[model samples]
Target: MLNAMSFAHTVGNIRHHFPGLPTLLAKATPERSGDILAGIAAKSAEERVAAQCALADLPLQHFLNDQVVPYETDEVTRLIIDTHNAKAFAPVQSLTVGELRNWLLSDEATPERLAALAPGLTPEMAAAVSKLMRLQDLIVAAAKIRVVTRFRTTVGLPGRLSARLQPNHPTDDPAGIAASILDGLLLGSGDAVIGINPAGDSPAVTAHLLRLIDALRQRFSIPIQSCVLAHITTQMAALESGAPVDLIFQSIAGTEAANRSFGINLALLKEANDAGQKLNRGTVGDNVMYFETGQGSALSANAHYGAGGLGVDQQTLEARAYAVARAFSPMLVNTVVGFIGPEYLYNGKQITRAGLEDHFCGKLLGLPMGCDVCYTNHAEADQDDTDALLTLLGAAGVNYIMGVPGADDVMLNYQSTSFHDALYVRRILGLKPAPEFEAWLAGDEYARLMLEATHPERLLTA
Candidate 1:
């Protein structure tokens, strides 16, 4: 029989024992309200540290052997295990999770080496090492690993930061969305994408929005892509009905059951991916998927159980979501960090920490990871919190951030970064928009348009 895996650590006068890998992983995660709500967070600070210590001592190979979610029951787990590159793993095969952290932070872990190691590292291993790292360590280490992707625009380049211009309208009105798009363009946003969350999911509405955005893109000759963030099935229906589709968008989670709750499966995602690629819509390259994930998605769906039917922590589950993103070779992957509200993240500090952790884990896993630096109204956070997080993410080399007008999404009823927020970060960090978009922005017509910019509200009547 295979020996059971257990971990223990001595903290002052008490010794804490964890029964298995899942339990240890849960207890080691930094405090978050979602894990507490799931009844899986560390009981005390000492226990959290003890679990971290034990996790540091555990070898990296244990992750491959001890699947958090069982392979038979979870396709995500199988994908993670089945697709691991043993050849790439050769460099750090014997290192413990703790040593992995040290190596990642060491001078020897150059950008090329880190890029080479990306396919070998699993999400679980990424989460474990992140728990042992400080905030600066997270930033420094993530900066070294660059995972670039391209559609019409290039993203995740070392010195470039992009923005998603979200021109959402409460009624899905074309005029309102057009005005907002004009606002974003004038402010130098929309290099990442001009994606909208439709007020409804009717494929007719989706196709209309797609055509509207595409019309504007063609009218102005902007070198950017557009997406209507409807359900994947709705996008597929629209695509079938001859709507212009640039990138297929979906919300994915870690577990099979959670994904089912969202009415998606791996097969369905693959189908959507294939459809988008067949459109041949991209001008620069063909990485044609956009995925959004959050920490509490699984538990919220009542699908957070791990090996032996124990509750897995939310952060680890969030990391697992990256595996799903990596598999598709997506153009963009972002954690909607605070959009789920305070129930999961609880406060600004927790949201900030989760954003950094998500970025670090995703970049380490070789994905073009961005962040929706945002919060809902009811959350214990304000604009300042998003401002702090946005600046930090820029410094950490985040690929893109959301550009909701005035930092408010009237349709979605949440606060995200504004178009000016993108300008602020780019100015301060010496970062520019994607190359194609930047070239367009520097054109004489763009400068003349900026100087002759009109009131955005007037566009509705015009």
Candidate 2:
């Protein structure tokens, strides 16, 4: 049996005590408005650092013992425990959380080694180590790990970047969506997947949008996959109606309760994954599920509670969501980082930090991680902030990013990176799109303008 545990640290004259593991995790988290709003943030900077100091000394094995959300009530916790690779974990099993952080930044954590370590590290463990890292640390460590996946094309390969061509429209108008699709394609984007967030959820509407995108792909012989980002059930229904479903899309959260709030569970996700796989649609690879998560989703849903009713911080909950994603061997998993708005992220710095954290944690946990790198009008962030984050993610070797027209989603009413933005990153970072898609960009129809390096406006006119 485990003994009762208490965590405390002294900063200057004050001794701060964290009553429980959840509280320690929460207090140790970097300052974010979401934790502050949830009433779980440290009362002062000193206390926060004290929590961090205390957290650094805690043995890594304790996370395996302490259930932040008890295993019985939360299947996410159960999944973490039941699937953990004990042998893989043995290397770092003896170390404290702080030692894990140092090792991650050390020369030993190569891509292959980190990939092997992925099955060993739990989300709480990843989140714990992340709190002790700076932004550059997050970037350098995340870049060292590679979690590649495949659907119609390869993603997460080193020295390559991909973009999700999000041709979203306010009315789901075919013409407008096609125009945006053309824009992304001409600009050498959409190698990740041409995903559309439908305005309506009706099965018929979803099916129609699926047909539209599939038709475009077939007609052009584009070496890419297409998805209509509807709910899982809606996508399943559309699939049953014989829609050309290439990938199943859903918004997932950390806790079982938060997932329930989203009208999803593990069984349901498995059903959807099975449904997508049975289609036999993917040519290059069979990874067919797509998942999107954000930091504040659990708190926003009022399902962020842990053992003893202490609130789990949003970043930890976000990391937990990655466990859910990894379970399915998904083709794509991205955090819609700033899309949750200022109430959670508050400003540019927080958004940037959260993006790096999400990317780092997701990569650490063996997911093909990406970020939306977006914000709303009400948020205190601007285009410059988005550009900075976009470039940073590029440098971090992020697998994919969203490619919206003009950096704006008319339907979702948010600002994201544009097709031109993808070009800029590729030029600056010496990255290219997926190999299959790059070959297609050199085809007859697009090669004249795209490959020859003629003016972009000429392709626009074409």
Candidate 3:
């Protein structure tokens, strides 16, 4: 039996669960005002304008005026203009998968050199580089088509597929893994999304992420999106022991508990809201993305513990998703709700395609649904499941789907499942096929050479 209620109660219940979450209600004191404006001024001109607009109709003039000073010297403006022109006028060059692979696996990649480069890297940057390299590897392996693949990768696997075709090799350093992925992408295929699970908030993880960011900035100038900060509680612990705070949260436990500790719902809401405001003051509303939190449907589910124990019923899952959505609405514009049940492995077989279409996909899309293709062991089964899943997702108004290639019950031979999945998704979304691999590879090579020639220190120095 389930109790249905209004959106307000749902939000209220969520507040009851997480009592310690911060609130944004504290009056904006004069000092806080200056901090906010200083943060705004540090942003790019475009960002400054956007922030101004956000504050325009609000009681923020005193804060904005006190914090932001007019730029008279025009030095920052000149720098911005010059950087844009440089990129616009830059010539492109071609790179091959084989060439990039050789560079990554070459003897030059000694432990000493890697260590030397480590200090300069950050966890976020490392994560980004890892993704780029993984994409490069997939492109090289397929050698045929140009495609842009975006998904997170786990520690030992190569290719985006969860079901590894090859045995897990022992020598797989996270850094090396990233290097390989980027090499593949540079040789041309498409962009990749790598998941960063920092192992124990060590400086090492932070360094890795930084290096990755640097490499991507040097090569593509693309912004990294879809950050997956899983099991935030454990991540915070690691950071306390010398990990980078920029890449890890300070209090995942307090954050998670506050969300659930009944009496403090309003306070939690305030905290999240305040954090959102701080993030907004610094970037175009676009850059500061936030992932919403919700109770998990089952223990066997893939996400961390705080997300568990919500029950397995579709009604229950949907209810929880909706509740979480309402609670997070004030803070996050983008969210990923798990529509699939926790016992998906056992129950997935019983789930008729229509059940997925109507209940899970349809209902969940009221919030931005994060379709998790959990059972990807068999490609055919996975594809059948996903085909049904995607059709339903498209109908349900889902905008994003997260999955690993060949990781489920489906066996997507390089040509069919992976290629067709990307193709179908692109078609459904009305996106054009990405640029050709040959062209991308050429551009990547030029970028690599340019970095090597002009700012090798960016890679080697912190």
Q: For each candidate, how many residue pairs have backbone atoms clashing (under 3 Å)?
A: 0, 0, 69
Q: What is the lDDT of candidate 1?
A: 0.92
Q: By lDDT, is 1 or 3 better?
A: 1
lDDT of each residue in 1-462, candidate 2, tens digit only: 133357999987888999888899999999999999999999998889999999999999998998888897899999999999999999999999899999999999888899999999999999999999999999999999888888889998999999999999999887778778877898889999999999988899888888877866775578888899988999999999999999899999999999999999999999999999999999989999999999999999999998888899999999999999999999999999999988899999999999999999999999999899999998889999999999899888899999999999999999999999999999999999999898889877465434533433332221
Q: In terms of lDDT, which candidate is stronger, 2 or 3? A: 2
Residue ranges of candidate 1 with Cα displaced over 4 Å: 1-4, 445-462
lDDT of 3 by residue, 133-237 (tens): 332332222222111122221111111211111101124244443443343233221222223433334444544454554455345543222222333344333
For candidate 3, what is the lDDT? Answer: 0.28
Model 2 spans > 4 angstroms off: 1-4, 445-462
Question: What lDDT, from 0 to 1, does candidate 2 have?
Answer: 0.91
Which 10-residue window of candidate 3 scores lowest in summed lDDT? 20-29
RMSD of each: 1.8, 3.1, 22.0
Which candidate, 2 or 3, would have the higher TM-score against the true structure? 2
Sort order, lDDT high to low: 1, 2, 3
Residue pairs in steric clash, candidate 1? none
Candidate 1 lDDT for residue 398: 97
* Weakest ten-residue segment in model 1 by summed lDDT: 453-462
